[model samples]
Target: MVKTAKKNKIHEQLTPKTVVIKIAKWFLILFFGIYTLFPLVWLFVTSLKTNAEYFDNPFSLPAVIQFQNYVNAFSQANLGRMIINSITVSVIATFINIMAAAMASYAISRFQFKGKEAIFAMFSAGVMVPLNALMVPYFTIFSRAGLLDSLNSLRILYAAIGLPMSVFIVRGFMDSFPREIEEAAYVDGCGFYGRFLRIVLPLTKTGLVTAATFQFLTCWNEFVYANLLTSSPATKTIQIGIRYFTNQFTTDYVSMYAAIVIAIIPSIIGYMLFQEQIISGLTSGAVKG
Candidate 1:
């Protein structure tokens, strides 16, 4: 049996079709790798250039490296304050969003009750709704509640805005989780909450991490509602701080690029931390989205 398997493997490796397929896979991987990372490399390069160098040749190397652009992003602008605000808002909103999603998805997926599917459907439908269309009503409601010009407004809206998608992803993951495990937990005298807290929650780590990654990124990058809801600099987020270098009359292009690079760092960090879980979660049938 061992000799036969080895012979088959050697035969497969030597086949022209298999060789061609392997070559093509490597080629495509290289192509996509460059495609995705090229823009980031170009942006970093441009961020180091002066306005004169950028204008003279957008693609050329900088004559003098401008390390001050990064310093200016912090000194000249409120980038520091805005980064803190973004971090605070994103973390709090992600926690709330994930907790709510976990409970909602668990109940909807595990319990067979009348209108449960309908509730899930309604949540799913929210993803299709255009947020721009609701801006007027949301503005009125927040205005009445006096949440306008507050980070609390973003916290609430960000959690609510991504709730639909978060529910969708987590629910899909829960749906595939085996009922037999919970049944065994019940046989061991575990109550519903106990089983969920100990077994279900811990086992769903990948799905939760995936959902949290999405929720955090959404909250971090959200600009439209952040702009509409907050007017004062005290409530402004990093997304709004990126626009600091622009006006009708003039623009600081290099400084804006530097701010953008700074803005992208947290997202890259988040992805690097959760990328394993995110990739596995998506591949494990949680991407019914």
Candidate 2:
């Protein structure tokens, strides 16, 4: 009876401490959540404020909602074309990057050939190289090939830049999958393409989605190559197009804020939708022995 009473007392003491720890965890999450979301809230607020209200009464509430800012942003900068161009480039680059990386990762992960380890190591070393040094060579090659000032140039560059990282991620996920799965497909008379497309691809959907999301976001946000490669307004992406908000005379804060809010919406929606898959893919096989 004494022992039972002591055990109960110890458990009761631990319960409050556990509850306090949980509260602390939640409080920390709330703090970071508000901290992260505050900028987005401010962008929306600034978009709603008029130029006069923004300058004259900077801290005061907006006297009137300004719907024209969004309209002007779309019409003045030809942002509609820019959005379309960005969408096309991001989608094309992401598809090529994910598919090519998946194939390369599968080969490196599954197959055993002579000098394979050396080749894989070489590929891995690319992850450490800085992109800035490659810009001159890229410019020269694209110019010589007559690909400059074209959408194809943007797509190719985005895919090339994103490939090494995607390869690393897809290879990691592929390593976690069992070889027996592919062998079973082979037993069913599946060839290399069939085994890869039917057996391997389905299992790696989470990893592929994560890779594609990352590639899409990277391509969409890329500005240096876009600004350097494209000359015409039709080929310009939203990131480059946003520069129009800063003309030589004065910057249009209201229009710029609205455009930024608009541009961020698509990426946020995509990430939220694939949040679970991305988390799982990123952490699947880091501890394998």
Candidate 3:
């Protein structure tokens, strides 16, 4: 009788409210999962279909899989050159932005000096500045400097644009880090650079990966700046190269879809690789200060 009563009491603890909440949570998860994945699934399906098939039955599976579309998309779009350009620019820009932001964030987060808050505020404010607002000035400045129409110009621009957000993210993570480690290093005669290079940097790997992922994606997908600044075929990025498939009159939907899939692969791979770190870094410092 006693065991039966206790079992009844325990089962009653899971109230109707709790059951409803659980159901709602799963509902939201299913809803968003379908919403996010449907577009990618459709894009893949469209990429495999011929233009005639696409026109005949857009939503149905491809009657005959056109593997040649991928090859045509690659060669005709000159994605080979564009992919190389995007990787080079994104990699170099991400490296420079991460290195500079890490150093700046470390100084700001660890040091005490006049205008420290002000400096941090300035970088944070840069995040609000829209890229479109600076497009004209960037064009004029680069044109006069004889830097337009070159990959170096794009590299520099991408690095500069990514700096503010990187600094903000890294600084937030640094601020949340325990200071005892650094103090102990100091007592052991470790200088500022040594402490930063050895202890702080390694401890902040999640933050660094988060910042690098953001910077790389920004540089890779950026189209307006690439289009405005770069005029030559050799310097154009994948985003800009995608425009070649469409003009005022005609649009190659199949090839264009294929190219989009190619362009998005790197970003998907990158996110999948560093998703845990990104989630951890974003949430770690969120409640710290």
Taken over the whole model, the C-alpha lDDT of each candidate is 0.93, 0.88, 0.93
Q: Is candidate 2 or candidate 3 better by lDDT?
A: 3
| Runs of candidate 2 exceeding 4 Å displacement | 1-23, 57-59, 287-289
The CA-based lDDT of model 3 is what?
Answer: 0.93
What digit string (tens of lDDT, one per residue) describes model 1 on residues 82-195? Answer: 999999999999999999999999999988899998999999999999999999999999999999999999999999888999999998889888899999999999998999
Best by TM-score: 3
Q: Against the hidden reference, what TM-scores do the models get?
A: 0.91, 0.91, 0.93
Q: How does candidate 2 fare on TM-score?
A: 0.91
RMSD after Cα superposition, model 1: 2.7
lDDT of 2 by residue, 25-59 (tens): 99999999999998888888888888878888665
Candidate 2 all-Cα RMSD: 2.8
Better of 1 and 2 by lDDT: 1
Descending-TM-score candidate ranking = 3, 2, 1
- Model 1 clash pairs are none
